[model samples]
Target: MCNSVVLGVDIGTSSTKAVALTLDGQILGIATRTHQVDRSHPGRVSMDGEIWWQEFVGLCTELSPHAPGGFAAIGASGMGPTLMLCDAAGRGVAPAALYGVDTRAVEQIRQLEDAFGAEEIYRTGDSYLSTQSVGPKFAWFRQHDPEAYAAARTFHMPASLLVHRLTGAYVLDHQAAGQCSPLYDAARHRWIAERCELVAPGITFPRLAWAGDRAGEVTRTAAAQVPGLRAGAPVTVGTIDAWAEAHSVGATEVGDLMLMYGTTMCLVATQDHRVRHPSMWGSPGLVPGRWTLAGGMGTSGAITAWVRDLLGGSSYDSLTCDAAASGPGARGLLMLPYFDGERTPILDPSARGTICGLTVRHTRGDLFRATLESVGYAVRHHLETFHEAGIVPRRAIAVGGGVRSALSAQLVSDITGLPQQLTRISIGASYGDAHLAAGLLADTPPLSDWNPVVRVIEPRPEPAYDELYRLYRQLYESTRDIQHALAARHSASAGEPLPDHRATATAPERSVTAPERSAPVSPAGPDTPRSPR
Candidate 1:
């Protein structure tokens, strides 16, 4: 096929997207299907895996006519630490459990802390988990839903499970798998049979693959469900979507870091070697032999969205502009973006959000401004660990849904006093997946030759920023005790025991005894058994 294109499929919490792109960085077609996350309770969130797969297949075909002769390469990207169960037939045995924000696993969290000493855990990887961790979710499953647990044969992330359905292969990427902390060992690059036994005993695990490894081709039958894709398109097992975005933004070189300002503010740095932060994840990113020093703010743009939703308007532009006008430090008001809960630094799953030093004189604009600075403050928190470990990034690549406004980017640069570069492919992971797919296929082309930076934000250090950042550091350290106290009180009212630090590493999950529960359910209704693809 002349001008061969690569297809990228990005499966996310709220939607599934696919795109058609040329090796020369030309976008030929794109499609997205929105899906709602079921949040029936304060601590529960899930999606039906069956629905995700169907939507993905449906969208691919819908976008196919936009690119002629089909795509020559295909790569997938997805959210990480996403846990779900499948029956032997490969159908989702139940709704998929999401990561980063799900809080039902608080009980499991307590159990983990009891088993793995906090000091030990911090030393190993500083990866303090939230209800968003995959391990505890499994533990919760085994304790509360014994039957479902007994029937579940394998525990897999959403993306790997999707690949299994499409290619009939049982495979996962290192980045995706690595996020399955306490299940997959980042240092060893293998499933820690012992830890998995302690946290999720007997749950079957998928075969592992490195980022960018070939995961087999799309089946002709599966291809029929999605349009514009050739059955034999080379499919590469992909990396976590965040990692994919970092790659797409050209944050692959050493010393260049990416700060993703989306639902959350995530930081990922490209380093020649693995650098672990007691509060961050140090895993292999997109390139081999390179470490991505990664961490995230539990909340970022979400708070901004919250303010708008609260104000009941499309006044986001006004709010941001107003915040910009109100000046630095928001008149001494500070916000803690733990509305849903926290992850990095303060890994407290039970922590509640806070807004300290609110005054009658402070307008909503000032609060909004403080909220923006809070997000940047968190960036500083995660970055402090990087700095302590000697992982010096020259600057950070700012990407994601949050960088649309010039003022927002400028605010971040000002807060951190670091240059923030913005790239052209703002669609992020989906675009990154296309780049990966194209680079992998012999018929496709290279990334450096294609995707290039569109603009860069130079550091504009402000006089007030130094003090603002200092106050930001003090906020978390000073208020953690109160946050936990709030969590305990809330837990007592709900009749649930408060989670303790001991719960970060050890909780029990079960195995699937029933054939249907052995693995993820495939398409065609997940009722049949799985053989090789």
Candidate 2:
């Protein structure tokens, strides 16, 4: 039992996290270290890949001693769509450019539209520049920083870079490559050179491998920082965080959706065929033969976190209580939750959040409730899109910080009317990576003996939530233009002669808005239709 531990590292957008688990999926210890996501200027977000690796090593050491023995396998996962550039030595020359929200690539979107009709691109590829991708970011770097592009020897995503640093091997996982979008043709299982050249001609990222496939072994170099991490630990290839989150919940069947309620809400569902919904996200996630229909909302738990800070800077209990005080529909006050830019439905990074229908009659509870409901509204939109694509979610498992609250889970259920399940660890994405890795190791122990969920959160659909959702759907159409005007004002303020990456996409005409004003509401109760605990 002492020799049965495994190591899992989850590289998030803003931090690197590590966890120690036994082969049966039980976590023994956990550790984390935040890495800065540099957004010094608008339209640009960057980070050093080395920063992630070093922090990961630190966190692994921090978590390892508790396990008492060395790990059986090493697993890793990371924030999606963070493209890293490297020299021949695998050192990051410039910082990594981040995902869809980074507007530096909007110009690249136009170039793509011009080179190949937008219709053709979307129909064939099932994706666009609306965030969650690295192609646009790559195009922006090549066009604006040709000097850096010329000097770059190889391209990588964060996971590939982690694998290389761990074992001095530069290779990619196929699931991690989904965001390469047009660069990879899912149907053909090969890179599409013509599609890549439509934007960045010379860029060739690492070759792809399946998640859980062994890339290389750890070495003495990695062991220096990661205490007790065996140099010969079987190193499994990595995956994206959300994919790992999906595995954490045991959401492995077709029609099962995994809803990750974290800083932003992410939904990934396994489906029989490729799903191309213009308003939703679809990608090639872990299961190679099966396709994944993904849906992301710009705001979920983040807006609630914002409200928590604003309202007397109190605890989540106070915030949830505030939300509970207000009845469903947030007393007619609704928020879009697009504060950072949106993904699903609109796919407009230029879009923003909004608070609508505020009145003197409204209290803190009403406002708080609306923010919570906004997540449900966005999730329902995602669900509807999947239904259209013929992928109805039989059940959804909740994984993330939001699952801590019973009310938040209920709101999702009441709004969507689907049963939800929570996990014991819900420990972000890395554990899932380790879980899969251990299951695939040559001398691996059975996962069932190691990891087991502590509890499950079941959605208790409330009738009042349905009425609130109705109004939530209509508020955006009513204030769409107003949101656009705000973005225009934002863009106009940018002084001329900024770095290419500093420029953002033109604000869309207010055809929509999410949370325009900060609001609050009760931690609504979880919906009924309970499952076995």
Candidate 3:
């Protein structure tokens, strides 16, 4: 008998990827479609909801032909916790408001904090409201785009949105819901309806399920639209892409940290019990009774891409080679990797990227190396916070496209002084989604057998790196005020309102019902052409 197969698709920040694999872990086929967030406006980053479904369909068309025996189940994951408000018919009311990288909700964040005490939110949700929380984004939509908000019957993240289109089920994974903050009660594992109403009045949340639970079977309409998928195949309720990426490398064990180096640098540390910190996020794990402490840098690989493009589209291979040659400290250069503000630890949206120590003699290589080293410093900063919160990881697994670069991974290890295990199969979250789907079967093989560690990157302590890291921290503190002022100027020039940091709690409470129709405003920006992930 032929081995059964499962398919997994992930909508990422810069691309959509899919994989078809058998129950025993052989990859049958893989496909990817690149896309970019629309960033035509400062502090606004998003993508059309239509692009997600179209790309999923495109991936299915490309991979389905290779899966001759067909699939037993289909799983999906994506960049989240994003806010994609949709009507009852599942049409997106507006472009999705992306995660922490899009810092357009600063005012709304403060508004929600005042309405519900910040400490109470942290105590109940196990996380503080920041750019990452979906609650604030909802408030931003209601206040800024009342027409869309009035039409929006429900809100969906990338994962949930795709699941709804595929299975005709309006469901969200518990892990994703936990990131909604104030709207979701982490301990209770359910929506706090009253609190949700405070931010998203009259909005109905989708049914919640574990990431691995079967959300529903593929509908005939969806199957026909997607070409390769079978109508009756079971679909797993997928979670955020970072969690799936963690599971991809078997980094789900307690005290294991999965550092995903993608468009955004994300860190997920597995914990047996809830570990809450004001800076980091605490969410339910892929499996029940499991928990995770998470942090993400607003940009990592994104910064590298920007530098590469600015240098006239140099190939990444050439850039990496040049960066590697630049050596430790990038020749006295230091960079704060806050190109899109920052997420973890500091949680400052007004923070801006800054580079120090420039010279006329500096080459593009030096700039590239500085960018890479800056990400390393940011990783160390987050790891230090993990230690301070008493949630240190015993083992670290590195996964994502960035791991293909030895210099990048080694720099991270050297800076953090932690051994990072590299898995043989590092296709990332889509592969993990397939693993989760396979596990839904009775006779699935162990995940360990599927993906094993091929090599370990041990830290090479360099005194120069240590000194640079110390200065990297100081540089941020010394220049934070300057960065904020620059951010304010950028916002003003873009005709964007600066966040009212000291505004009184006098904002009028608006009803959920539709009011007078004003000029249509795009919350993020116009749909831009697709770009590479």
Clashes per candidate, residues 3 or more apart or on different chains = 24, 44, 0
TM-score of each: 0.88, 0.87, 0.93
Q: Which stretches of candidate 3 lie over 4 Å from their true place?
A: 501-533
TM-score of model 3 relative to the true fold? 0.93
Global lDDT of model 1: 0.70
Local distance difference test, per candidate? Answer: 0.70, 0.69, 0.84
lDDT (Cα, tens digit) per residue for candidate 3, span 19-108: 998777889899999988899888788889889999988888888776664567888899999999898778999999998888888888
Q: Residues 366-463, candidate 1, lDDT per residue (tens digit)? A: 98888887877777677676786677788678878789867777877777777777766787788888887876755444444566677888767678
In terms of lDDT, the best-performing candidate is: 3
Candidates, ranked, lDDT: 3, 1, 2
Q: Which pairs clash in model 3?
A: none
**For every candidate structure, what is the RMSD over all alpha carbons to the true structure, in angstroms?**
7.3, 9.9, 8.7
